[model samples]
Target: MTIKNQYGIVKIAIASGKGGTGKTTLATNLAAYLSGKQKIILADLDVEEPNSGLFIRVERKHEEIMYKMIPGWEEDKCTFCGLCQEVCNFNAVLNMGKLILVYPELCHSCYACSELCPEGALPMKKQRMGVLKHFSNGKINFIESKLDIGQEQAVPLIAQTLDYVDKHSENESLVILDSPPGTSCPVIEATKEADKILLVTEPTPFGLHDLKLAVETMEKLDKEFVVVLNRYGVGNAGVEEYCKENDIRIIAMIPDDRQVAELYARGKLVYKKSSAFREALDRIAEYILEN
Candidate 1:
């Protein structure tokens, strides 16, 4: 189904509150299945270590340098009043006893140092945090952001990757974003403005707890979401009960299939081998189309 929202694109984010919960497995397979019928791309926003690319072989289309501006010390403009240090919550700016040290690697690029710099001593400098890579293999379009080593912030790269998708896929039908795990700033950036969010979760207690956190985040962001219960038979019924009690929709359940796991271990798409996984994704895709 070619679903389009106000942005002229259907942005569906596949996310999980905890890692190893099968978000990449769901996103890649869903995108691959949908790509046959629609103009779609799978964006791997887990820049810290993007593994979705390993599942699919894609020809490199292009690359763009994603940069973030951070504070740069200007010794000429003096006056280290410690305001920059006080304002920084990330501890990026360390007002040394003599030399005011500015660690761009540690900085979140919040501009607290530059904005509050009374002396304008710390000017903004361009720091290459990552590169957004675009790939295409006939019908399958893929995009992923790779963060440079020592770069602490991932939200900027995620935003850049989404911007790349928008610039190229404005007329396309769907953009499935593989969001980073946890309800953190990076996850927030990845899920923002998504037409629908498919939360991947398991049946364990930890899974349910983190799913609750993810549900809270979705509620706080006022985004519509449904839970995809991965490894359905492995854990307790807590997640299902919580979803039922909270009135959350459990869209699809991908059973604990050894075939799926074996295919995944081989760096293959589990849906391609297992009928159960394919059926699960088909149900979720139909739900998206219907809704």
Candidate 2:
């Protein structure tokens, strides 16, 4: 199926401009709320630091290693020609007359050089970047990805996970994707095809600044977007002011409570059936269901 299809399901992305903005907190709660109401897939696309699993206990299903295809050289088939170098746009392939160099770090793994090699000297190779973890929390399908340390690119892993979700979701279940904190490539990758994005933020200056960055990204992406303010009274009112000035909707505001932090530290969720966070989240969730 095409990535654009969205499998006739609402794909909601919970993201943030900076870390420590309660991104995963909101995501986990939203996923839990939706899972009980209907079928759902909760995917943590923050490959570098996947912490959603810490909040929700799940049985680990079988996982598989995720690989990326890079280019390799077969020295025996080399003709010393410059076709490989000419076709490579990433500057990953280098031809120095007698010696040819392949820089894996600079490679985009586009395979242009390998495909155009006149002598068929270059072949594609796989590099283990990370693993795709499959999990199940009763009715909810949980997907959390972990990037191997020092891996430069996480967009590929995020793409692979999205593709896997599209292929695996045979029913019209909501896909709640928990994205990395930031407006970087990884965040963009996670929210690129999302049906709706909830930008989580606090009430401080940094929160407003980073939310602006995330808003800029959403404007460029041109997707349906909203904002969720977490820990409302802990910081200044900068976030609310910014949203009001920009005409952006504040979908929900979760009050700052010490009990929430204590529960989070103990690996417990704060958004329960009677909690204010869950009530606000349920209202925001209705947008997906009603739309």
Candidate 3:
């Protein structure tokens, strides 16, 4: 299947309700498949544990540290009025009469504490949270962001990675975002700007349960999304039945193959070896291009 340039840059986010659901598999192979015919920008937005770079062979072109703003306490300027602590809704600031403590992890970077400080004791300062790397191999441009160990928030890093993708992608490029799993703040931040979301799930009972939560999340966000059933032949038809009952579209079903697993274990792309996997990717690419 060939993609026409009529759609401009189509941002497609591949996400799942849980981990180990082949979210990275679908994302990596789909980007590789599409890169054969067109320019593809594949971004791994799973900042906490990004692993999409494992499957693709690309040279790192750029790397940068990502930072988030947190309030810095200036004790000399403080009047001990306790206003900063009161204005912080996240409990990041604490007032202890003689001294104030600021917890960076608890800070949401809303700037409320800094902006509302009456004595200018609280100033917003940058704190390192993650690192973003840009990689490429001719047709495929890969971007991955990884959060620093012990970083509590993924939304800020994910947002920064998306900004990088937006700034670098061309108008005709197909941008595919590999989002973090689950229906949480990180996933929402990763897929918020996507033109369409593809939720990958298995055929098991757990898959169906989490898929329901993911569907509900997309519905609340009013985002257009479809399902892609991974490990199709291993589990029961519960996920299929649930999708049918809900009138949700299943765009593609990747079959369960041991060779696929073997290739994946070796950090290889299954589409290069398995024809069935390639065919499923083609279906997904066609759906993306036609829509």
Candidate 4:
């Protein structure tokens, strides 16, 4: 099948500038709303702290151990030259007189140490970072990445998960991806071939500022996108005015409600409980379809 037809199923990515902006909340509810209405894949690309599973409660169907490259010290070939430490940008290795100490948490798996180790004292080893979990809730496919606590880079995990989705979704489905916070590499990887990018932001100054950065990033990627005003009453009205002035479409607006907060605290998808939010989510789905 052609990629255009494969992708014509509609891929929507919901992302934000920073964390705690209700990005996942919006993504999850939207996925829930589109659950039976269409063939949908709900992907949570927040590898570091993916919380979509907590709300969706889907039965995990497939999981794989995620791995990354780390330095393996070879004691026999050790020159104790300390060049590895010098070239190591993450400070993961420290050589102290006949002993090589490795702080795994400090390593970025950049392979600079092994490359610069003249004595070949360092080798690359695969280390488990986390798991790529796949689940199914009714007709919706749920995918999530949970990075190991100390593992810093989530880009690889996100890339691998997206690859999994692309490979596994051969049947064609409306893929709605929940991207990680910040317009960083992980977010970029998640939203990479997306048909529509939804920037979810609040009304606060930080929200507006970060949204602008995210919007700029999407514009550079040359992807079709729109904005979703989340937590509509947190701060100034500048985001709305900015969207209007910039000719950016406001696809949906979710008002800040204590009940929503309560549902979130209880780890639940709002569409499961609140009819209003469900209706709003349906409208968001309709907007996505119309656009």
Off by over 4 Å in 3: 1-7
In candidate 1, what residue range of length 10 has the lowest lDDT sum? 1-10
Write the residue-wise lDDT of candidate 4 on 125-152 in tens digits.
Answer: 8888889989986677899889888778
lDDT of each: 0.87, 0.84, 0.91, 0.82
lDDT of 3 by residue, 1-291 (tens): 445456578899999999999999889999998898888999999888899999999999999999999988898999999988898888889999999998887889999989898888889999989899999998999999998888889988898899999999886899999999999999999988999899999999999999999999999999999999999898899998888998999989999998988888899999988888988988888788765
Cα-based RMSD of candidate 4: 3.1
Q: Which candidate is the best by TM-score?
A: 3
lDDT agreement of model 1 with the native: 0.87
Superior by lDDT: candidate 3 or candidate 4: 3
lDDT of 3 at 128: 89
lDDT of 2 at 274: 37
Per-residue CA lDDT of candidate 1, range 193-288, in tens? 688999999999989999999999999999999999999899799999999998999989999977877788889977767888889988898778
Q: Best to worst by lDDT, what's the order?
A: 3, 1, 2, 4
**Quick one: how many clashes does candidate 4 have?**
0
The most accurate candidate by lDDT is: 3
Model 4 clash pairs are none
| Candidate 1 RMSD to the correct structure | 2.0
Could you tell me every candidate's TM-score relative to the true structure? 0.92, 0.90, 0.96, 0.86
